[model samples]
Target chain A: MVARITFESVHAGQQLPRLDVPITASLIVAGAIATSDFSLVHHDKAHAQAAGTPDIFMNILTSNGLVQRFVHDWAGPGARIKGLKMRLGAPNFPGDAMQLSGTVTAKEVIGQDRIVEVAVSGKNRLGEHVTATVRLALP
Target chain B: MSGTEKNNWLEKVRAMVGREALPPQTAADPVNLPMIRRWCEAMGESDPKYLDGTAAPPAMLFVWTMGHFRAGPGREGGTLLGLDLVEAAGFTSVVATNVEEEYLRELRCGDVLTQRITLDAISEEKKTGLGVGHFVTYRYEFSDQKGEVVGRTLFRVLKFRPPAKTNETAARVDTDTAGVTQPLHPRPAITRDGAFFWEGLNQRKLLVRKCGSCGRLHHPPGPMCPDCNSLEWTTQQCSGRGRIHSFVVVHQPQIPGFQYPLPVALVDLEEGVRIVANLRDIAPGKVRINMPVEVEFVEVGKDFVIPAFRERQAG
Candidate 1:
């Protein structure tokens, strides 16, 4: 069984562990396969450049999943994702390293669950790539 | 002889303890335009650039792989799980709380595209009035024909079930909303060329552009067939019915000043035309996959109307 944690156990303004994830061609390819999104911008570099993009931009879907993974791994299996909102900033290219970091914003008790909101962001070697608001529900 | 004997012994031990190899997760296929175009048309996209290759819109890229899992063998090998896992775990419904996308490049026809997908995270939380729910996150990377990267998208889906006590309250709310239901709206006044389409919608029917040269059904009401560039065409009325191929309930609005808690669906009509429209008459929570629906015209404003769907009554 997974261990349970509460809202009162953690402090507000606490920063979670940072995650260093490598972005690879294979990782991008696998994401496309799973999502069934086959826009040329994700696969063809020449096409992307021709269309005025610096490089292939990472799918917003994949970035959200990455943020979720980073927080879930830290919060353990018991943490439940309630809501997440993010804005696309810089484009993520293959062969770049993405560093994900987050800070706890607030905590409160709603019904039988304890909820925590985390402000998260993903940056690459080129600087900030994406940022979002995450709400997690804990026991 | 002794050195050979030692190497053989090491090989035997390695064979006994099988190496753990990570499963292969790579997309190797072309982005089928026919499939995507069908989805765009079904979603009520009327852009000629999407059909003409003149200028493709950004959102049309989302339809690149609509129902791709069911397309062919070996294609669905990967674990492409969506927000539906919560439903399998007994959740009543799932909604998209938010979605943000950026277009790195425009996709054109004949561009072979590839995608990579991974599960980012799944977390649960309690709602003040709706009870507990889980949010699932997924990441996607898109590539084009020449093995060059293009763009990426991140999506989050929120799945939830009604609390035992809240079920009754939800049903009551649904009933109250349905009580004030109004009739289908009238069609808008369109010009000479676009008149036939509006007329068809007023009659509760779907129309497609039939190409003269290719004899294929074209959508988005184009003047010339993209395949042959022939301008000759005719309109065909189709049954205003289809199955819910895929759908999402919007808990958060994409545009400001819009209403919330709307169920939007991608319907695959019987005439082989797919369009996106708002699902009506049924309770938001009761919407399901493969739900039979019939099209109805709803007037949004003066001289403007849209096609909507209502759940077909069971036999």
Candidate 2:
């Protein structure tokens, strides 16, 4: 099992390690089908083209999963995500690369656990793909 | 991507920001085992709590709000005509960019959820790597049947014009169901007292045990009647007519062997006994509290059947 992060070890202004992820057509489509999102734009090339996109692109569910994975991997297994707020900035199309990074913005002791807030961003070659804030609890 | 066109497009679609993009609707199913299994499989999550039916993963909070493929009209709010408006303005492509959810409680089986959605914000035209478009956001409020707030979410998607045919080849259609199968529900745990209830279901009969001493009835074939506390009891066939006492549409954990948005209900039987069962023959969103229903047995697997309810026809 991966080692867990303790509340005492984390502090504001700490930067998490960055991870580079290669985006693919299959990755984008797999996310849609897995989440039961049947929108044509996420998988159908002809339909997506007609809808005015370069190709089928990643869905929000996939982006959310990526974001979740990015944070949990850093916070370790025992950490609980309290909340997440995100905004889409760029498209994550197939054949592009996404690099995810984050910084601890604030930490406070709430009840029995330490609640740490992190500002995270996913950027691709085109530019920023996703930006969001995630709240997690560490014991 | 001209300035004049972008301005015009934003102006037309911006009118929807304060409107109800999606109508309030009930979930089709209560939280169940089948959907939960599927979600875990997809996400590669192996949390023991989910598998043992202890607590659903908090990340799945949004899944309970989703409408299934065969879902009826007015059930979808986020991608309503607002997206169409942007598409018409030549911002023809759309992709979900962001999602944030705050879970207030753990979802469990048999908990019915109702959700209301409001369009929150629409960004002005902006140029991005994908193309020139606007970002639209929706705020979703989820509550259980008791009207307790379960969770809230803010979702954002970008509607943009696609960059010129970028990928040399078209997107491939995938037909990859390598290891997927229908999920068999957890079998009923039959004890000496409950054995008769299971047997009744297999016999296509809905039975409520009646106290031999007091004639007071109790469902689930208890050893002793609750009201009279009598050990001796006999079973009585039910009339199968009832009203929906309470219900919940389950959305999460995507377990196999069942459909999404499954509706489970607590029925107030005409015999004055209450039983919990799956509701059928009606759209999950269309089921109303106190709606009349009748019991029916559905054959799920070989030699196994479960009681399900259907909307009763009005006289």
Candidate 3:
């Protein structure tokens, strides 16, 4: 079981803990599969290279998932995601590492529910790969 | 290699259009909870909708249609959609370039699915960093038990001949491109002490080693026993009954002799010894901890039989 973070304990302008993901070929391949992005660019190296990329890279869906996980892992099982949107930039290829960082941007109270909006960014050596805003409801 | 040969090659390929790329096939396992659960767990999706196991994720359409390895044929060891014909003509390496899909109905547990793929289009010769090749596209349609279309996908691939290189840096395989009769399974490393174990597989039996001093049974047929330090040992025929202790679905480093997302398991035998082998007659999503299984000998290629495990029906 996972521990939960109460709405009262979270504050705007607070920084969440950082997570570094080692972008191995296996992780890239498995992450794409877990998200149901059954494209060759995310799994087959020869295919990716022929298509212009150097090797298999993380798919946008997997990036969205990695962000969702970053938020939930910080907010805990008690947290529920209300909305999530992202913009992808650099391609996260194998042999690179992604540093996922986030900050609480705002908080609100609606009836018995407390809604929190978090701004998240995942970066690699090339640059930022994904920038997103995650809105979650905390207990 | 000559002008007339080049023209005839494309003519042969052109005739395959609107034809079945490979023989019609069915999903190895029906849409079920275990596979759905595994995907959810890996993606960190804890939604009650999926946890309750009613509806499968819409994204699993292609995965559900992934085929199993069938010994012998035009496919690259039962994969690749008869692309050997393309490879034989000179385009040996392939890369998927694009895909578009549409979903018509939701897939649920107990729904068995089948697929039909047709070669839809082929492009003229193009030059690139990799080499000169053509862009081949196929249309895939998936149907359910009632023969209603559930989903469709347009898949495109760029098949090219690898760029030429000098001897000092060349690593390309010769484009012999025969009908892919290569062995489809990796051979077990037979050794002096482990010879009996493989020999048992030849005779369709499972063997465990018993320590002559204390009667302790062990797996892998080692020369010495860990429990009693006994140099003496003998063989015991096993019942081949077991339960899955642990397992994994391997997807990386794409070994040629096997399929991707291969399911391998550590099976705890009823005789109290554990052995590792591949799983058969089931999908990766169907494997579970403590589930009952039995040993099965499958001949994956010419005289290349390997020991694998299959689900044992509960009594």
Candidate 4:
């Protein structure tokens, strides 16, 4: 197992590892169902097409999840995300891939603890799918 | 619809704002390991913290009190504050536009969640590429078994009238998908409970879940052993030797990533457990029950591998 990333070990401008996420219909639909999003566009291809997409697209909750996973995967366990601010752009449709990459933008020391901020973005074939600023407290 | 009619309809629909979409609904099951495992699997998430600790993935905040769990089966579910009104107004299709959540507390196993949702707002009909429709938002307040507020999420959706069906418009529906290709294989839904199995596979070993208390081996790794219901368990490596118990050939609705007619089999391993895997190196029609097979680890994509079986060679 990789050592858990620590507050002392991280620095500004450090690029977290990249993750190439496969956007499958199963993933899109499973995330919708898992996140309790039952909206037709997140599952039904016909409705998604009618709603101005080529196929069933991902829900915001699922997109949020994939982003969090990206961070947790890099930061290792025991690191807790304080908050996430996200901006959605292109829809994450199935049969595409989202390349998730992040860079540490800033770090703060608060009363003996370290909080790190990362600027993360997911890009697909069309363009940026989702961009987020995630804050986490490292142990 | 006339201006007077639209005005009256909007007033009636807007008047219902702040009304409860449903009675305060409680989660059918408490926060649990199994559901968490399943979620991690679908996400293809491999973090071990979710499995080792009582804390669930924070991303699952909305799952506990989602529509289906609270409504129970055979119940009206996934209702927006003014969904019926919007649908009645000819905005029959819906798509979520955004979601914002504020987590106030950590969610742990055995926490029963109850939530109340009310219509927050419904915007005036606006023209969009999909068609003229309204943007609706809902406010959800969640509480745990102790009545302490745990989280809040705002869900925004566009309830729009679909564009008139045309050959080109129909063709555009799939425009987002026409040029795409399937990757090596769909990721396996491996959770922490089954992480050991996959990790073992990475080492070229076939491991089965063994109950530490009863000394019984079980396939399809689970948190609890069915025989002794023991929470304690270990793993034992198998020789990858098995026999086909039953098999099926899939030929329809071809999903990208695998060849068809694909042959999938349920094999009884010599270690006294049954496992399911894809069959390789043989024609689909040539497979039969009780045929001998051996496990072979095949890497379909970068860092992605699955245990498949091939026909056992003669002794």
Candidate 5:
């Protein structure tokens, strides 16, 4: 019962609204069987294009669970995720539709919790995928 | 392409873990936080207390070593040597450049976590425009349920190529004298609070301790004051100099008896403290960025020694 994304409706370069997400190899083998990560370049695509990876390669624990399900479905449900950092430039194949975006650089409050600081990215259709650093915790 | 298909995928990963050492079946289950908030919203991570853990943010304990799963037998032979070194080198993709972790604790949930992988290193070079690939380095070590050690993961695998065959000639392996550059034999006894900072770095002097309550200056030696835990200190001596805040030429050879390009350095001393040591005399793509350095002291086994850094000589 928590869904709130409203730091005055966010500004500082506002974007957050891309979320395409398609990528499937059975959803990356159900996210490598929910993160036990048997690693084979994330589930062997002929050993991930023979270790030069072109496919099967998005398993930094499902890219941190798709950046915690896009900030818990758009910063809601009592939003409280605090420190996340993503850095894996490319690679999220499967069926590939992937988009996921974000912006609001800083909103601020700190003491009684009301921080924002977003700058996420995860594109597709061949563009600029994977690039993150979200820090929400508003109330 | 012989030797039984190069030991047939490491004997099918040693026949799927056939020398059991007892340590697999780990998933005490607890950290699901909506599957870690749908993997931090597919890594767009809007860290709301790592998706509401009541405010737990310590690098989300690096995703609590990703849940857990360690059933053995060549433990799937390191995933069939990444599918036999990408079907015997025909590379052109594999990316994950840097991911240095070193957290020690703070991973809650049910906390069953237990990993012990050990495919320490694996190498292969030749990149005349990214051609002859291979650079595997896995060394997980996650432990939980009281045993301690909450983290340490170093999984780096590049492998990408497409140009190399003008008459092949880049495979002359076997030459890794551990960390190389040796000399020190019997010299370890810097005891109690790093005995006068190893007697002022064995006389070559470069001491630093200052901390009369957070005045801060410590280097490698600690007994307190990581910013005012202060045991009230004092030592001073650094003139040995510094600079070069970052470096690395380590032609991906993951220490297992190393060799083939190694130039590690992170020096920043002037009593400021940075130390990641090991650079010696030049070469390694020249090295730059504040340059000017000093301090040296090799020597491998036996009494063990380490504190390397060079390049310094201006007015």
Candidate 6:
């Protein structure tokens, strides 16, 4: 069962539960298409191979979207994402697995809103795939 | 890569910074009600200001200057030139990584916008999971017809060379021919300000919200009235009658659960505002500008239903 989280229930230094995600070719390409990103390497395996990559890889936009999903899933419906500063690392290729985890770094109150900061990371077999600092405002 | 070669390429790229990479280009259509209506429908934004034609949503900072899908305005020359130089330098693949926007002014209908793009920064060569490449950042400045800056955005992208696979054998690429289903109709992004529209649809009643103060009727319902800025409003049942003020046919990027060459219409409702919906029960070619269409609720999924339109003969 999915547990609901609230600002009152959250504290600094709390660890978020890990989420496992399966990377697939369709997910990589669909994310690229949905964002109107037409870079050949994102969808064309042949082009990717010729350019030197072993296969098509995920784009940063897809990674950003995944991070949003991860944070929202844990924060519950009332949480509002204010900002995300993320950096990509290892490539997420098809047939691989990505595990995401995060920790609450800080919580503050400002003008009737509770603001929380989360330091999140996603990793695969190759190592850390993405690292990010996400900020959210909750009532 | 040799040291001298790298230096030469770096110099060429460095020249792009601090210069207007994209020239100011005028918007094809000044901010208008029809386009705003379409944008709100697609984004599921029912903000009353956007519907009543008083002010446009601030989130639409980039929409004012975006050209058509394939044949619209070209990217700024300097930015394009810099990209060409980078591509020539062996970074052949590119993907946008991040966007940060700051809106300064509320754009309204009839406001003509122009944009200028400046190359902000270019990172040094970096090696990681996605081969080697440089990160390029461009700052877009959007201004009004009066040359007043209204908004700005920082867009960053990575251009890299694909890294060669070490041991994995080549695999077949996935394509639509693999019997990929059409995309399901996208769920509306509901918020507190616009929940009533969906509720009205559930009862099969076309509801238009009217301001308690000004009595102005607006579609894409929201809590506040744009005319009077009143928080009080009431819902009125519409005749479900409207005419196609504009239409478009989508053909490519087939999503699952939707027919290709989908016909979407922007109907000017009898209530005096406009709404957008799919034109059903008619072929794409038969849909004409200014044709009369009426509302029809479609059960797209088990718990999801949305209003679609059907053609009607002139009385």
lDDT per residue as tens, model 3, B226-283: 9988999888989999999999999875554576689999999999999999898788
Q: lDDT tens string, model 1, A20-114?
A: 87877666655544445566656676655444333455665456556766676567645666656676554566757888899999998878768
User: Candidate 6, which CAPRI tier?
Assistant: incorrect
Q: Fraction of true contacts reproduced, model 3?
A: 0.08
DockQ of each candidate relative to the true complex: 0.08, 0.15, 0.06, 0.18, 0.10, 0.04
TM-score of chain A of each: 0.89, 0.95, 0.94, 0.96, 0.34, 0.94
Clashing residue pairs in candidate 3 are A47-B95
lDDT of 4 by residue, B1-315 (tens): 988988887888799888887678888778988888877877766777677546888778878876663455633465556788888888887666666676777788899999889888889989764467998888888899989998887777788886654323333422225554433244564677999998888888899999999999998999999999999999999999989999999997565467889999999998899999999998998999999999999876544568999999635
**Cα lDDT listed for each candidate:** 0.60, 0.76, 0.74, 0.81, 0.59, 0.74
- TM-score-superior candidate, 2 or 5: 2
Higher lDDT: candidate 1 or 6?
6
Pick by lDDT: 3 or 5, better one: 3
lDDT of model 4, residue A53: 55
Cα displacement (angstroms), candidate 5, residue A132, comes to 15
TM-score of each: 0.34, 0.57, 0.44, 0.61, 0.27, 0.50
- lDDT tens digits by residue: candidate 3, A61-125: 56666777778778876666665556666678776789999999999987766989899999886
lDDT of 6 by residue, B55-95 (tens): 76554556667644456345322335478878888887776
How good is model 1 by TM-score?
0.34
Candidate 5, chain A: TM-score against the reference: 0.34
Ranking by TM-score: 4, 2, 6, 3, 1, 5
In DockQ, how does model 5 score against the reference complex?
0.10
Candidate 5, residue B52: how far the Cα is off, in Å: 9.6
The TM-score of candidate 4's chain A against the true chain A comes to 0.96
